[model samples]
Target chain A: MIAMPDQPSRKPLVELRNLSKHFGEGQARVDALRDVTLTICSREVVGLLGPSGSGKSTLLNAIGCILEPDQGWMRLDGEVVYENRWLRGNLRRLRLEKIGFIFQTHNLLPFLNCTDNVAVVLHLAGWKKSAAIARAHELLADLPVDHRKVAMPGQLSGGEAQRVAIARALANRPRIILADEPTAALDSVRAGIVMDLLHKLAVEQDAAIIAVTHDEKILGRLDRIYRMVDGALSS
Target chain B: MNLAFRDIRHKLGRFVLTSLGLSMLLGVVVTMAGIYRGQTADALALLQATRADVWIVEAGSHGPFAEASRIPGDTREIVARMDGVSEAGSLTLQTVQLVQGDRRLRLQIIGYEPGRPGGPATLIAGREITSNRYEIIVDRQTGLLPGEALKLGRRTFTVVGLTSGIVTLSGDSVVYLTLADAQQVQFDLAPPAARREQARGAARGSTDLVNAVVARVSANIPASLIAAEISRWKHLSALTAAEQETLLTRTVIERASRQIGLFMTVLTLVSAVIIALIVYTLTLDKTRDIATLKMIGAPDRTIIGLIVQQALLMGVSGFIIGTAFVYAFRGVFPRRIEMLPADIAGLFVVVVLVCLAASALGVRVAVKVDPARALAG
Candidate 1:
């Protein structure tokens, strides 16, 4: 068991200790993570750097509360959410209220336009439709993508869709944002622009952001960077 | 709700095309159900038009349709003398081919007394059969109008009046005539053969036997009790109005009813499977989007709701279009397609249930999607 992090006067916004994840069983079991520990304070943009097959994505999933780890303690804003193989009651509600996620594929719902895509999370989190749409418009205007707010996923360019996805992630004003390779599909210019937006949103909104990326160009903009190798994080 | 409506609008062409296909399937299903209901209604209409309380036929035989039933014509007088019996009439039923112009039309001839209980209730055109001979009342669906001439055996009869919706169990049109005329047509053999047979049998009689006896009872009398008393007599089977209807449906059209029921069940099952496939395919196309939604903290219930709403929309749209199409084309159907309100309501309930059940496949697939896959490179 890993020692519990000391609870200071103001605790970290997100924490993971001794996290491990293994896929399959017995002979086929492959350990994807091994005793990983990490943290991100509010208003910080932390970058997770690694080569392919590293545990960066595995760590991100554990933080997102999507994959239950084999052994770990996970906390969001000083709350002990997971220990080893179990989660606290109402993890779904917790996810809805506390977490947002962005993926490499710009996985916007094709059926919904940019604005509705962004507003969906707030709607799911029990916001009224008008309020959710208003918030979505505000976020899009902030990102300066409001001109294409009515465009569908198929109608938007790669960078525009990714920005819409980011707007969707911020819809519920979550405490933590988990972005897995958010810039992987864009060109260098577009990638830098998206990373800048992520950094600006993190600092301006006082939200914690952990973006896992293989793109080294955006690494310099991160507040801190951690590299992962062979299922473990390294300084 | 916003997402659901927006998604449907965004994919309007695909949704409408799929709905059209579903509507066609529903149309066939509704038509099948209507046909079955029509069979039941037709059976009831035959009984209702008779205006009789009791039916008497040969013992151990289902009369009017199932088998040949011949009882002495004097049996009507015997039943009229029974307790609670007010009036009785003899009726004969036979299938014959009538020639009109160059066409040969098959008809079920019904013979009844002119002023008795077994006559037609109303005529839609022309006058009722005033002359005892050489005049016939034809079902309007038979395509014969007033003053049309039809040749039956060596006799030419003029169509006096036309009645509606009086087809036989076999779907053949019906022709109603006086007892004397119907007896001649029903017992008419080749003239030489009839003479030779009569000579050989050595039986010449003025009395004409009928296939069955129809009796009207006093409204105060219990028909069941009268039927029971008549059944007590040897060599005769008696049925009340309700029993006669049951016998017609159970014994007369039982095979056709079973066939129609099986067809309806098969169509319903086919409809369910088609809906399931369409929903499953639609969900499969959106697997990645669903995973992303799941990863973004959309609950399982939300995803399930989205899929189910789509299925229900498809079902409702299909049902509305199908109902409209059935009603619009009902008259053009060769056989009657009776669309009753109860049947429509029942089909609506079934369609909703089928939609819910069909959506289960999509819901299962959506729930099983891995949120990790949304992040995978």
Candidate 2:
């Protein structure tokens, strides 16, 4: 499929058509993603729900430009970023400028304090340290663990650590945030709080969020949900 | 925002301990180098101070340090008569262990004629051997002051003058006496041995033997030519000053120098391997963090910088601490130890290169880390 420019207001923040990924060839071939397509608009929080061995993560990774799809037409913020091949010359730079990721374990660098955990992303994107740290403080200010901003990762409670990770994911004001089981390790109450924070940041920053999880309890917190079963997707 | 420093700060104690261990290893290499250099200087010290242009010794001998070389005392008179020879002196050398107070001190006794080419060029204390028979000029390491009395070979000799920084290749202090006194000290036999010789009807061997006949050739005259003429004499071997220096350094201390060099190489190799293993282990420890860093789109330089900087920190700190350790205890070592700034700097360069090479194992592992692993459960 050829990528066509979408008109401004109707254009999706992230768009994919006919994306597929295969792990191996011949008799042992395993399809990780099968002709899957997805679209997420600004200010929308979407969830990919699936059990273990399902292709939810494969789709998320493809949308994040981490692993290119075998075949796809993809676009980000009105730019045709992939056409069966990555059009971006530097994939790392593209990821830094356009995407944010939150892992299940709140993978904050153990060496950095809470603020530096967030500030490092901005600094990597060429922001000056003073401004980057100031921005980190601003992102952390609204979180419940804002008072613990100077604490190391090991010193943080599970809730506090997740909050710091959220601040880091939103540090660069990325157009898209991909969270893989963002609340998997938190208790129900903290999970609710984390979902609320993601929703609030999505609308406030006008950024799209794609969360992959099997936690049906938080389905109500999402605007819409897509389900995956054995490498195929259904709405 | 320095990642390497931040990681190090988090594990500050472990990092410092690792560097300390590396420093101890490096200190051995440095100390060995110092000993080698000091030994070389000590081996050449008296040879350099003698100011002799030519040396005549027993035929086919490498003496006075490497092997026992002896020639007749009157051989100097024959060398003095040669053309281009300006001055000559008979010299004798022997090593003796003497009981000084409660301890035995090993000394290199050198006997040279006064006002000749073989005597010390300068004195650091009092005057030179004023009276020939029982006066001695000793190196400062002996702890003998001017006018101090010391006993050697059944005679109590008075120390009339002192010299500094004079030692034998084996790091023994050297003392100077008149040629006749040295021969007596060296060749004198105990009363029992004299009786045995008399009972056997054996005549006493000549006590007029000298270790070498030293001479100076006139300016613009080649000392080697004078040495060649002296070499033609029966039972006499001659060497120029340059040849003597070579014989002293290359022949006298070659084995020990080579052994120390081997030790330096082994210690350096051990240091590199330790650093490599340490850096590799550190990299393995932070595999998850590295994955996240790459996942977050940090440039490859940032990752490389982290490992390389840590390696360099270890190497530089090791060298600094090692050099400091050697210098701090140089006087305590039995053998003389010396450190030169240029030599230290050169060692530091080698250290840096070794560290970079050592870091390669860590860098390879870090760069190959899959950023996609960060997304995996």
Candidate 3:
């Protein structure tokens, strides 16, 4: 773990040590992540600030269980999931039970309405259809766009779509939530609203939020912040 | 919560129109098969109606549908004397085109003795032909009612009866007449041709010529034995009813059936490729959606299920519409379109297999999609 110089100790929800990833081979190779180490406690909202192509997205993807780091020791909720190699054979089930992702654009299925958009993940997680839908309504009721729960993705504004996407991420009740540019498409005020909502959800759901973005204006909402330069992170 | 169904519901109008277009193509395919079946049935129908046990054709001839066979009309009397022969009849068969009112009708004229096995087995309307001359019984498809006068060449025959389902090998309606009238129609030349023939010193063919002499054999004695006995005669050949049917189907119309079969094969292959292309396009449109589903931890089987299910729905709906169209237009079709339950069931199974094969391309694309792409955007 990275040396936390004046940080208060809390129950760690996510931990990474000596993680490295690179693309291509020989002279064409480019290192996207280098010995990245970090620790995130439960219910904490952390901001990942980096310039374009600085490996913020790569780090987020690795943490989201979608990318496999070449060498790494990673843990989620005190369970070692990777040690130079993946420990879990069923990575999909691990991702479903432990991780949630909020995409840059609200990638809601156009065919399903907002309620179904949120409920689909829960249904995949083995919840009964009616109960999953009921839980989806409950999550939507807490968000500002609850009134438009029945609306389709095309019928919703950018801010509203993001809100539905948020409900979807939390629908599976994952302990580790990864958001990539969660509020990039919104105006400053709407961006602040989304950040505030994420912070509230982070505490209320008792989940760790690691958001990767370049929007420094909303950095004040995060409880902790880390900056990445040249694929290495510095707090 | 089937994902395929939801997508279809979202674009129901486009989906329905695509299925409609596919259904018509499938309709042509099914109709072609039905036509082949109808041809086979028509060939069999003629034999079923005649109910003859053995046929005495000319020596060295397959006759009469597959090849030409002419024997003297008096051969029936000689055949009736054979030990196992129960009844024998001479039939004069010829295809003639007649103009009834404004319509030119092509008909198969069959001449048989009134009480013979070669006559029409049943009449749906009016009385059977009683007179040996100038009287005819026409199938209902000929559009001639009883009491209607059908003029053939210089002779006008009164339509005294109507029959249904009595068709020739080529699906043309049959018009039955007495042996003498049919022989007159088949053998007698027009006045001009007769005069021209006389000037050339070419005597006309005998009016006593019959296509073949049909006979009924005793039930206990096999017809093949009587046929074997007749084959010993120098000027005669005998064919059991079974041999005639086999010759008709295997040689006379085999090439035509094969042509229809070839057409069906080409159409089915084309349909498979069209379905594959259509399904591939649909999968391409949902690349991002599929990635999102993958990123959300949906299993690979789930993605495959969605694509395959959509293909099945298209194929099944198209098949139903095509079969319905075949049924709808069967009455107006000039030839019979006959399909047995087994034929329909076989076609349906083939269609399902085609749909499964067609969905293979889409399934490949779906399973290969990178879930990380959903994060990139």
Candidate 4:
């Protein structure tokens, strides 16, 4: 696959240039990410397709600031957030305030209900509990799982849990949404539903989303899809 | 914010069961502390009941307890003549065993001059001794009633009074008697023993010698000053009332208290370890959840707070339940179990500290958890 030829007219919402990350040393050394370069424009839904150990997850983690890249120039909303080896500010607070993450397992807090799980980030971002919960209910109402708003994660079905995770990601209205195989555990219908929801959220919220997945069923609906192999990426 | 509570609620049965187990351990700790205090109280009961300001014993003796102290029975007269001394009386202490019907009873026999310091201070039944020769005051624990005949030495004596909460450091019931009667019981020997003692060329000791002389000082004078004056005598050692009390507690009950104290300390430590193990197990069970929390941008404080808060709740609840359990069953114990408000408060503080220390185990595990694991398939 060749890299997408058409460059967006607007500044990319997220950009990673020549990022490199490695594990081990000497003969045992293995590059997990090899000078990976990519950009996601606002409202863009970028799909990362890879098998296990292909480094797509690594790229998502680096962008999410879960792990600092050994070398990279990364930007979010055209602001330099990571350059070389230094971060712009506190990575955790950056992630809390500006990045939203969805996981393959829909890692909703088991003890919390759907509304509470979604409201936690809002509360962390300084919203009052009542207001945050209200916002969470509103987001759930917009999603397909509004009826399960008060249900605990353990009680929700797989698709319903994924819906709650999406609502939680959008709680803070973050600029970047990172999803790692968000629909890998769902049936095709449920996977299509999650993909449609992600696309709808991207267009409506103008938030860039990068989802890593092996499910090619939703690839045609994505704005662009990148295939990763042996720590390298191609479109 | 209250995720810890939510998790606890989710596992309410397990949490409650663990708390109950922890509470039982805490109950033992509390009971041990109470026993230690109760032993101290029992040790000092006789001293406090005497209401004397100073004690005059034989020179180089810790009195009645650590070493034998045989001062002249007439030492009371000498102590009374000292300036600032308001009154003085001879006192004797000895342990005696007696057979009453089929039961064998051991008691601490206290000898005091009638109408003087060293008499039974509180009587719950009957009158104080009227006869200087054959009447005795018995603690209620001895199962003796007024008018009951108690045999000691070669003579049978009638119980004239009953007292409570008086015991020796070894936890024997205390019996009170006239100084002369106690002396006869203490020093008098059987006919055959007397003959043997005479053949051995051992002098028959005077029956008037008492263990110590207890004295009260006038309100204007300090007992320590009079004691200092008495200490100058070549053959006499004088201790202020406080010193005597300290001697009794430190020497008579010191080992017992230390044993109970050690037991309490170990129980507390065991409680902490048990809590740590439980918290660590709970954390291990929720490792993935914790990692997910971290991946969702929860700070280290939030994650640690979840664990520490749960541990603290368990500890505080366990302490309350344990303290309640101790209070409920304290009387069932054979020995006195004294739970003072101050002691209870102190134990609560110790429990809280132990709980926090225990939470450290879980906090370490939680903080070291890799948030990136949440991203793994």
**Weakest 10 consecutive residues of candidate 1 chain A by summed lDDT:** A1-10
Per-residue lDDT over B1-377 for candidate 4, one digit per residue giving the tens place of the 0 to 100 score: 58899889878998888889888999988888888888888888878888889988999887776678987778898888888998898988888777788888989989888988888888999998878799999999888899899988887899999999898777799999899889888764335787698789998767788999989999989888998998898799989989988888877778887888889888888899999999899999889889877777788888898999999999998888988998998877878889999999999999889989999999999999988888877
- Superposed Cα deviation of residue B22, candidate 1 (Å): 3.2
Per-residue lDDT of model 1, residues B275-376, tens digit only = 999999989988888888888778888889889999999998998898899899988887778898998999999999999999999999999999787887
In candidate 4, the residue pairs with backbone N, CA or C atoms under 3 Å apart (3 or more residues apart, or in different chains) clash, namely none
Query: Please, what is the TM-score per model?
Result: 0.90, 0.90, 0.94, 0.89
Instruction: Label model 1 with its docking quality class.
Output: medium
Per-residue CA lDDT of candidate 4, range A99-172, in tens? 89998888898888899999988866778999998899999999868899888898988888988998998899
lDDT over C-alpha atoms for residue A202 of model 2: 77
- Lowest lDDT block of 10, candidate 4 chain B: B186-195
What DockQ does each listed candidate score?
Answer: 0.57, 0.64, 0.68, 0.55
DockQ value of candidate 3: 0.68
Candidate 3 chain A vs. true chain A: TM-score? 0.94
lDDT of 3 by residue, A147-195 (tens): 9899989999999999999999989889899998998999999998888
- Per-candidate RMSD, Å: 4.4, 4.1, 3.2, 4.0
What pairs collide in candidate 3? none
Lowest-scoring 10 consecutive residues by lDDT in candidate 3 chain B?
B186-195
Output the number of the lDDT-best candidate.
3
lDDT per model vs. reference = 0.85, 0.87, 0.88, 0.86
